[model samples]
Target chain A: MVMVPVVDYLRLEPEPHLCAHECTSCGARFFDRRNACAACGGQGFVDAAVATDAVVTAFTIVGFAAPGIEVPFVAAILDCGGTTVQANLRNVTPDADHVRLGMPVRLTTFSMGEDTAGNEGIAFAFEPAEQGGNA
Target chain B: MSDDIYILGISMTRFGKHPDFDAVDLGAQAALTALADGDVAMSDMDVIGAGNLLGGPGGFGQMLQKQIGQTGVPVYNVQNACATGATALRTVIMAIKAGEADMGLAVGVEKLSGAGLLLGGSKAADRDTWTPSGRVGAIAPTDGRIGTITMPGVFAQIGMQYLYEQSYAGVPLELFARISQKNHAHSTLNPLATYQKELSLEQIMGDFMVAYPNTRPMCSANCDGAAAAVVVSGDRLATMSAEQRRRAVRIRASVLTSDPYTEGCQVLFDVNTLTRRAAEAAYAQAGVGPRISISSSCTTASRPPSWCTTTT
Candidate 1:
C-alpha cells in the first residue's frame, strides 16, 4: 500500500517524524517556512525534525462534521518538546472518560480516502503511548 | 490633524436565515436603512466600503450600488474573514481621515446558507482542491490522521488545555456553559441577534455537542444578515441638522493588527496578547483609560479571565 502525507509538515518514512523549520537566531520552530523569525525578526533558519512522541496539552471530541466523516472524533493539541502540533487523538474511544490531559501519545497514520485511481490518501495522528514503551 | 470621526447612522437586518436574499441584496437593504436613519441621501455619500467573506461574482460593492442607483462613487470591497465588517468600517474612517471623503458609508453582509455544499463539505477531494496547499503549486497534505476539524474543534482543544492548566474553582465545562448562557441571555435584549431566547447553563450544556467541551449553544450559528453605518468627518457632522448631529456617535479610535506567528507553540498563542496590544493602542489614541467598556464578537473560553473586566 502506498501512503501520502495530507500536509507537507508530516514525514511518514524512516520512523514518522514531522518536518519543521527552526529559526537559527531565537530557536523558534515552525511547521512551515518562516522567512523571518516572528519572535525576533531574524532571517536565518535551518531544517528541523520533530519526534512523534508527544503529551496531550488539550483535546476535543467533535460530534458534528460533513458527510462521510465520522463524528465524536478526538482532535487535540499535543506538546512535542516545546513545539505544539494540532492533530487528532486515536487508538482510544472518543469520550470524556477515555481522554485525559497530559496523556502521553505517539505519532500514527491512517487512510483518509481513495482517489479515482485507487490511491489511498494518508494523514498523521497521535495514539496513546503504551506503558514503558515509546509511541 | 486630530479630526474627529462620527457615525451618523447605524442599522442591521434581523439575524436569521434569509434564503431569498444574497449578499448584495442584504447589503443594499442595510445601507438604505442606514441612509434613511441618518436622514442623509445616498447622493451625499462620497464613497462606499462593502465587506463580505463569501460572495459570488466579486465586486459586491458595485453590485450593491447598482441596486441603490450608482452615482459613480468609488466602491471598495473588503474581505478579512471574521473581521470583514470592522475592516470595512475602518476603511471608510481612514479614507475620511485622509481627507478623501467627508461622508462615507460602510456595509457588511453574509449569506452562509447560500454557500450550499461548500459550507461544511469535508470530503478529502473537496478540501484538497479548494483549501490552500500551504505552498504555492503544491498539493495540500491529505493525511487521514489529521482529518478535518472545524473552528469549534480547534477552540475546544484550547479550552481543554486551559482547563488542565488553570486553577478554577468550578467545573471547567461549567464555565463554558455559563458563558453561553450569559451570551444567550444578552442576545434576548438584541432584536438583531440570531438567537434571542435566553438559555440556562443546564440548557446550554445539554445542547448537541458540536465539538467536545463545546455544545451547539456555545458555538455561533450560521445566519444570513447585514449591518451598515454612515460615518462622516467632524466638519460634516457640524453641518448636519440638529437631529442628525444629536444621533451621531463618536468613533474615538480604530486599530487593526494581524496575529503573530507562534512557531506552532499553541500554548503561547493566546489571542489575549493581540487583544491587549490593540486595546492599549486604541485607548492611548482615544485618550481613554482602562475603565472604558468593551464589546467584542470574539469570545472563547481560552481567553484570559482578565478580559472579563473590560467586557460589559
Candidate 2:
C-alpha cells in the first residue's frame, strides 16, 4: 500500500507519533516552528515526541462539512501528555453515549482518499484505547 | 505627540453580498463616501492604508487609489486575517502619530463570497516544515473521516469544553441561541447587516447545524462589504472649519496584541485574555475605567458581550 502522511507533524512510519518543536528556553511545545520562542523569545528549539496515549479534553459533533465530506463526526481536542492536539475521535458513534470528556484514547491512522494511481492518503486520529487495536 | 488624532469621517457599505462589486470596487466606494463625509478632496489625502484578506489583480490599496483618482500619495495594503480593518486603522494612526502624514485614510474591504471555499488546499511547498499542522494541512485520519477541521470546528471544541466544565450563572446552551436572536434583532435596526430579520430563539436553534451548539444563525455570514475612516492630526483639524470640528471624533487610543504560545493544551488559553489585556491598555491610554462602555465584534461563546460608549 502506498501511504503518505497528511501533515508533517504526524509521523506514520514504524510507529505513530505526533512530532512537535520544543523551545529550549521556555520549554513550550508547538506544532509549528518559530524564529523565536513565543514564550521567552528564545531562538533555539529541540525536537519533541508527543506520546500517543491521551484523553479527550473537549469535543464537538460537527454536523456540517464541505462538499463530499461526511457530517456528524466527533471533532475533539486530545490532551496527549499536556500537549493538546486537535483530531477526530474514531471507532465510536457521534453521540453522548459513545463519547465523553476525559475518555482515554490512543493515536491511530486511517486512509483519507486515493489518487488515480491508488496511492492512499493517510491521516491521524484517536480511538478508545480500551478497544486495544493496532495503530 | 504633537497633537491628538481625530476621525473626521467614517462610512460602511451594507454588510451583505454585493455580487456586482469586487474588493477594489467596494473599497473605492467606501473611500469615496468617507472623503465626501469629511468634506475633503481626494487631493488632500497624504497617505492611504487598505485592509483586506482576499482580493484580485493589482494591490488592493493601489487599485482603490486608481478608482478614486490617485494623487501620488503613498498607499499600503494591510492583512491580518479578521483583524484587517482594525490593523489598517492602527497603521494610519501610527503614521499620523509619527508626523508622517497630517491626513490619512484607512479602509477595509472583503469579497469573501467571491473567494470560493478551499480551506485545506494549501500547497505542500508552502507548508512550513516546522509547523505542518499549524495551518489547514491534514493530520492523521480516523475511521472514514479526514482529520481536518475548520475554524468553526475549533471554536465548537472550545464551546463544548466550556459547557462541560464551567458553571457561570447557570448559563445554558440556549444562551447562544438567545445571543444569536439578539444579534439578528439588532441587525433589523441596522440596514447594513447581511441578515436583518429578527430570529426567535426557536428559529435560531432550529436552524441548520454547523457545529454542535452552533447553528447557522449563530455563525456569521460570509458576505462582501467595505468600511472606511478618515483621520487627521490635531494640527490639520485646527485648520478645518468649525463645522468639521463639530463632526470630528477623537481616537483616544489604539492597541494590538496576540496570544502567547502555550503547551498544546487548548483549554489553558482563554481567548478573552488577549482582548481583556488589549482593552485594559486602551482604557489606560484613553484615561477610562472598566465601567466605560465598549463596542466589540467578538463572538466567542466564552466572553460576555460588550458595547462601546464614548466618554468625554
Candidate 3:
C-alpha cells in the first residue's frame, strides 16, 4: 500500500462542469448533455457547475479495500441548490457518526493513485465547509 | 405481427470464467456460430450489434469485428449493464423492422473472469470500504467524494425492504440458491456451459457470501462467454422453405427506460415494471395477449435484483 497525497477536484482549474440541457421552448432542465432539448427539441444549454455548497444527501463509509489507504472514508451525493453531484468527502472520518444529509459542504480536490499504466492520477474531493475552511 | 424481422438462428458459448479470453474472442465465437447455424455467410451480414457489459478500451466494436475477420461492417456497440445481451438483440431486430437492413446480427460477450472489476489502484481496505462486499473490489470514486454507496448496498436494501414487507424472516438466501440451481441445471444441458458439475444447496450456501443473502453460486457467475442471433426480414423469409423458417422467433417487443430521478431508493426494481410495460406495448403491436398460445419469451425474472442496481 502506497500513501499518496489526495487533492480536491474543483481546485484543478478547468474542473469539469456539469452540463445541463435547457429547453428554450418549455423551460425544462435535464442533467445530460444533449444536442437537442428533450422537451422542445431546442438546441439550447447552459454550462453549470455544482454549487459551491451542498448537503451530504447520503453517504457510506468504505471499510473494504486493498492496503496502504485509510479505512472508512465518506462518499456522498451533494445537493447544491437543485443539482445533485457525487463526490468524496474528505478531512473528517467518513462514517455515519460525522456525516449527515443537508450538511453544508464545498468543492475540493484530492489525490487518487497511479493509473492502470502507472501514471499518477490525481482526483478532486469535496469536504465539509466547516472543516475545510480553516486549512 | 406484420412488420418483418425473424430470428433465423441463435448460438451461445458456454458461460463461465475464462481468464485467457478477452471480450472480442467470445464475441467472435458466437458470431461465427450464429452464421454457421443459419447457413448464412459472414459477408452477408449488413450490420453488427455487439453488446458487452465491460467493453475494453481502444474502439471495442472494431476490435470485436476484427477477431472474426468481418471488419468494415457498420459495427454498433450496445451496452446496458446486465440487459446488454437482449438490448443488442433488440438493436438488430429494430434495424430489420425499420427496413434499414434485411439481414443483421447481434452478439453479446462478457469476460468477467478476464480481469477482476477495475478498482482505482487502491489497497484492499480502500476497496473494501468502497465495495463493502464481494471479492471483486469496488472502484473508488477518484472524482473526489466518499459515501458513494455501491449497488450491492442498494440492492441489499431492496432485499431488506422486500424482507420487511413480505415478513419472511427466513431471508431470500434460498431463492438465490434455487436460481443458481436452475441456471446451473440449464448450463449442464448446455454443452458450452462453463461449469458442468452441479452444486448442491449446501455447496451454494457454503460459498463465500458476496452480499447478504446472496452467495457465489446463487449469483450469476462472473465468466467469459458470448451469445449471438441472426435476424432476417419476412420478405426474405418468404424465399425460404417452411423447415428453414420454423426455428425463427419473432420479436414481440423491445423497450428501454432510465430513472428520471432518485427518490433516495434503489431504481433497480423499476426495470421489471418498465419491461412489463414494454411487453404490453409489444403485445398490443403484435395483437397478442398472455392468453394467446406462444412458444417462448424471455423475462426479467432471470435478473437478480442486485444486478439491476445502477452502481453494480
Candidate 4:
C-alpha cells in the first residue's frame, strides 16, 4: 500500500508539515498555487515552510453537515506563525471547554481511506500540544 | 442626456417553495409583473440582464427571454455568489449609463427549495472511501482533516471571532440567536417574506444547532425566489406617463465589491472586509451615513444597534 498527502501543500515525507507559496513582493503566504498576489498583485513567489505549531485564533464545534459527512467536529482557524491555517482540531473533545482561543496545537496526520488502487489519502490536522493529546 | 438611472418599477415573487414552478417561471412572473407595474410593454425594453445561480448550465437570460419575449437585445448573465440579483440590476444600470439603451429589464432568480449547505461549488467529501472529491478533501472533509470550506462554518467563525475581539454585552450564543430573532420578527411586516410568523426568543435559542453560535432558524431557508425591476434613464422617464414618473425611485449611488487581499482571506474568505469597504465607498459617493431616525418606537437612542457592534 502507498500513502499520499490529500492536498498538494501537505508534505508527508520527513514530517507532516504545510508549505506555502509566499509572495516575493509582499511576503503574504498562502496554500496551493497562486498566479498573482492578492496583497500587492505580485506574480513572483517562493516556497515558505509553515510552522507546525499554531495557536487557535477561532473555532466552532460544527453540529451539522452534508450527506456522507459526519457532524460534531471542531473547525478552527489556526495561526501558524503569522500565516492563517484552517483545519479541524483532532485528538481533542469537540466542545467549548476542550477548544478555546489562544490554545497551542501541533500538526498531526491520519489515514483517510484507501481506494481500489490501494492509494491511501493522508489528511492533516492540529492536536492540542499544551495539554498532551486530548484537552 | 442625463446619466442618472431610476427604477421604473419593481416586482418580487412570493418567497417560498415553488415546487410546481421552476426558476425561469419565477423569473418570468416577476419580469412580466414589473413591466405591467411600469405601464410599459415588453417591446419598450431595449436590453435585458438576468441572474440565476442554480437554474442550470444554460444561461438564465436567453431562457427567460423565451418566457417573456425575444427582443434580440443585449443579454448579460451574471452568477455572482450572493450578489447575483444586485449584479443583474447594476448590469442594466451600466447599459443606461453608457447611453447604449434607454430602458432595460433586469431579473434575478434562484430555486433553492431543497438546497443543502452552500459549499461554493465544492464537491462533497466521501467518508467511507478515498476518492477525488472536493478541493478540501479527497476522502473526508471532517475528522480534523482541515478547516471548513462551507458557509455555515465560515459564519460560525466570524461570530466567534467578533466575540473574542470585542467585549460584547451579551452571551455569544444568545446574541447570535437575537440576531435571528430580529430578522424573523421583521418578516411579519413583510407580506412577501417566507415564514412570516415570528418565533419566540426561547424557540430560537432552543432550536437545533447547525453550527456553533448558529441555529437552523438563523440560516436562510432554501426557498425559491426571484425579483425583477424595470430601469430607465431619467430623460426616458420624463417622456413617459406622469404616473410612471411619480412612482420612480432614483438610484443615487451603488457600490459592489469582492474580497480584498488579507493573507487570511485565502482560506477563511473575508466577507467582512468586502462589506466594510463597500459601505465606506457607498457613504462617500452618496454623501450620507447612518443617522438616528425620529421613529415613534425610539426617540432617544444613545448606542448603536446590536448588529452595528458586529461589523464596526
Candidate 5:
C-alpha cells in the first residue's frame, strides 16, 4: 500500500516524526518550510528532526466547529524539549480530567484515508505516552 | 507643534440587531447623531473618515457621505482588523495634525448580525499552495484543522499557555471563566452593550464550551452597530464657542503597533508583547506611569499595577 504523508514536515521514512527548519541565526525552529526565520528574519536554516516525545504545554478541547468538522476534540500545544507544536491528543478522553498540561505524549501516525488511486493518506498525532516525557 | 486633536462629540447606536438598516444607514445615523451632539453642522466639517470591517463594494466613506453630506472634501475609508474604528479616527486626526483641516468627522459601522463568523475551514497540513476548495466548507472536519487560525481556539491556547507556563495545574480553567464573569458584571451599567445582564461564574463555567476553557458566552458575538466621533483641532476649538471648548476631551497620546519579533512568538503569537510595547511608549509620551490606575467608562475598577512596562 502506497502511503502519503499529511503535512510536508511529517516524515514517515526514518520513523513517524516531525522535521523542523531551525534558523541558522537565533536558533528558532519552524515546522513549515520558510524563506527566512520568523523570529529573526535570517535567510539561513538548518534542517533538524524534532524530538518524538513531548509534554503538553497548553490544550483546549473544542466543542464547536465548522461544517464537516466533528465536535469535542482535544487540540494541544506540546513542548518537545525547547520547541513547541500544535497537534491533537489521541487515545485519551477529550476532557480536562484525561488531558492536561505537562502530560507526557509521544508522536504517532494515523491513516486519514486511502485515495481513489490507492494512495493512503497518513497524518501524524501525539498519543498518550507513559510518564516522564519531555519537561 | 501641531495642534492637539480633541473629541468634540461621540455617540453610538445601540449595539444589537438592526433588522432594517444596512452598514451605510447605520453609519449615517451615527454620524448625524454625532454632529447633533457636537452641535456642528455637516458643512462645518472639512474632512471625514469612515471604517467598516466588511464594508461592501464601493467606498463606505463616500456612501456615508451620500447619506450625511458631500462637500467634495477628502474622505478616507479604512479597515484594520478589529481596530477599524480607531484607525478611522486616526485618519481624521492625522488630517487635522497635517494642518490640512481644523475639523473632521470619523464614523465606524459594521453589520455583524446575520453575518457568518469568519471561522473558515482548515487546510491540509502538508499542502503549501492553497486551493480555495481546501480552505473551507468540508464535512467531517477535525479540531486540529481549525485550531491554528480560529479566534476561539487561538485565545484558548493563549490563556492555557500562560497558565501552563505558570504551572497552573495543566491550564487552570477557572481563571478564564472568572474573566468572563467580570466582563458580564461590568456590562450591567453599559446601556450600549447588547447584553447588560451580569452572568455568574457558575453560569459562565457551565455554558457550552466553544474551545476548552472558553464557553459560548466567552466568545465574541456578532452584533450590528455604528459609532461616530467629531474630532476638532484644539486650536480650532479655542476659536469656537466657549461651550464647545469646555466639553472637548483632549487626546493624550494615540499609538498603534504590530507584533514585533520575539522568541517563541512563532508558537504562541505573543499578543502581550505588542500591547506592552505600546503601553510603555504611550506612558512615556503622555507622561504617565504604572501608578495611574486608569479605567474605561464601561470597565471595572480593579486591575494589577501594570503588564510588562519594561522595554524589550
Candidate 6:
C-alpha cells in the first residue's frame, strides 16, 4: 500500500495543548484573540495554549484535486466547545452522497500543498469517531 | 420648505483595471470633474460625502478632501456594497433638502478586480454550512468559497420561478439576452463605461453561459470605476436658465430600506421594491410622477443573475 501517499511528507504532531489568549489589562483568559476585546478595547494580546474540547457543529466532504495529486478529502468547521476550527476529516472514506450535518467529529491535523507564494499550508482536520465515542 | 434637490453635475472615471491608483485617486478624479462640470469652485462647496465599496487605508472621505485642497469642508464616508454611489447621492439630496447644506458633493469609487479576495456576499464563509459536499478533504483555497451564483442566477431563479408558476410565453433566457445586448449598446454611448463596443444578441446569448439563461455579453464587465454627482438647493438654481435646469435632474424622491432577511435572494427582492419606493417618494416630493423627462440608476452590472440583467 502507498502509505507514503497517505502519510509521507504530511507531518502531524498531536500536541493537544490548551489554547488561550492573555489580555494585557485584567489578565483575562480569552479563548480567541482579537485586536480589541468585546469586554474591553484592549490593545495587548498574547497567544498561549489552552485545553478545550470541540464538537462537530457542521461538516462537508471536500473533493478538490490539483494536477498529479489524488483528490484530498476533508471535513471542516469542527466547533470546539464554542470556538470553531476548520480541519480535514480523516480515517473515514468519503461518500459524496451521504454525510449528516452536525455529525460527531474531533480535531486533528492535515497538510496541503505549497501556496502560489510557496508557503506550506498546514491545517487542522476533523476526525470522525465510531458511534458512542466522544473526544 | 418642501422643495426638490437638483443634480447640478455628474462625472465618472474610465471603468477598467488600474493597479497603481487607490480608491482616493479614482474618487477625486470624478469629484473634480463634477465640480468643474457644475461650474463651482471647490472652496465654495459646503460639504463633501465620499462613498467607497471596499478596501482602503483610513479616511477615504478625507483622502479626497485633501486631494482637492478642501480641508475646511466636513467629509463623510458612505459604504453600501454595490449601491454605494446611489446611497451617496441620497445623502447629498437629503442634506440639501433639509437645508443642512446648500451645496453637497457625493462620490462612489471601487477597484474590484486586482489582487484581493473575491466577494460571495455575507454568507461566503458559511458555505460549509450551506454546501457540505464542497468542504470534504479539501484545503479551502482563498478564493474557493467565492459565490458562483452570478447576478444571472438570482434573476434566472426569479425568471424560472415566474415561468414555472405564471406560465409565461417568452423564454426567460431570451429576455435576459435582450437586456444584456441593450445595456452593452447603451454603454457604447457612455465613454466612461468599461465596455465600449457593441455586441449582437447572438454574441451575447451564444457566449459561454456563466449562469443558466445568462451569457457573457449579458453581464457587466468587472471594472474599477468612480462616479460623482454635485447637488444644490433650489435657491441656487433661481439664476440658472431652462437649459441649465434641464441639465440638473431633480430628485423627486429618494428612499432607502434595509433587508429583513426573509428570503435567500434579498438583493433582487430589495432592489425591485426599493426602486418602486424611491420612484413613488420622488413623485410625491416633486408633485410629479413618471411623466418627468429622465430617470437613471447606477446599478452594479458586474455579474450574472442580478436584477441588473432584468431592470434595464
- Residue B34 in candidate 3 has what lDDT? 91
Pairwise DockQ winner, candidates 2 and 4: 4
Deviation of model 1 at A7, angstroms: 4.0
Error of 4 at B110 (Å): 0.5
Q: How many clashes in each structure?
A: 9, 11, 46, 3, 6, 28
List the candidates ranked by TM-score, beginning with the highest.
4, 5, 1, 2, 3, 6
Calculate DockQ per candidate and list them. Answer: 0.47, 0.37, 0.09, 0.51, 0.43, 0.03
Model 2's TM-score against the true structure: 0.83
Better of 1 and 5 by DockQ: 1
Error of 4 at A88 (Å): 0.3
Candidate 4 wrong stretches, greater than 4 Å: A113-120, A133-135, B120-144, B167-170, B292-312
Q: What DockQ does candidate 3 score? A: 0.09
Error of 6 at B193 (Å): 1.6
Please identify which of the two predictions, 1 or 4, would achieve the higher TM-score against the true structure.
4
Ranking by lDDT: 4, 5, 1, 2, 3, 6
Models sorted by DockQ, best on top: 4, 1, 5, 2, 3, 6
lDDT of 2: 0.71
- The better-scoring model by TM-score among 1 and 6 is 1
Model 3 alpha-carbon drift over 4 Å, by segment: A1-135, B55-57, B67-72, B118-151, B172-186, B260-262, B265-272, B286-312
lDDT of 3 by residue, B1-312 (tens): 457678888898877776666777778788889988887877778788877766454356678677676547777887776677777787887787777778888988776664432333234334322221222112343321333233433343344444443555453657657656666667667587666778787787677654444555644445677889988888887777687588777665555554332332221233434445555665677777767735233321123443333221
Report the C-alpha lDDT of model 1 over B165-186, residue by residue, as the tens digit.
Answer: 6634455567878877777788
Given candidate 6, what's the lDDT at residue A115? 49
Q: Which ranges in model 2 have alpha carbons more than 4 Å from their true place? A: A1-8, A11-15, A33-36, A43-47, A111-122, A129-135, B56-58, B114-118, B121-147, B164-173, B265-270, B298-312
The models' CA-based lDDT, in order, is 0.73, 0.71, 0.57, 0.77, 0.74, 0.57
Question: Model 1 chain B, poorest ten-residue lDDT window?
Answer: B303-312
Across residues A26-54, which tens digit of lDDT does each residue of candidate 4 receive? 89987766778878989999988899999
Clashes of 1: 9
TM-scores for every predicted model: 0.86, 0.83, 0.60, 0.89, 0.87, 0.59
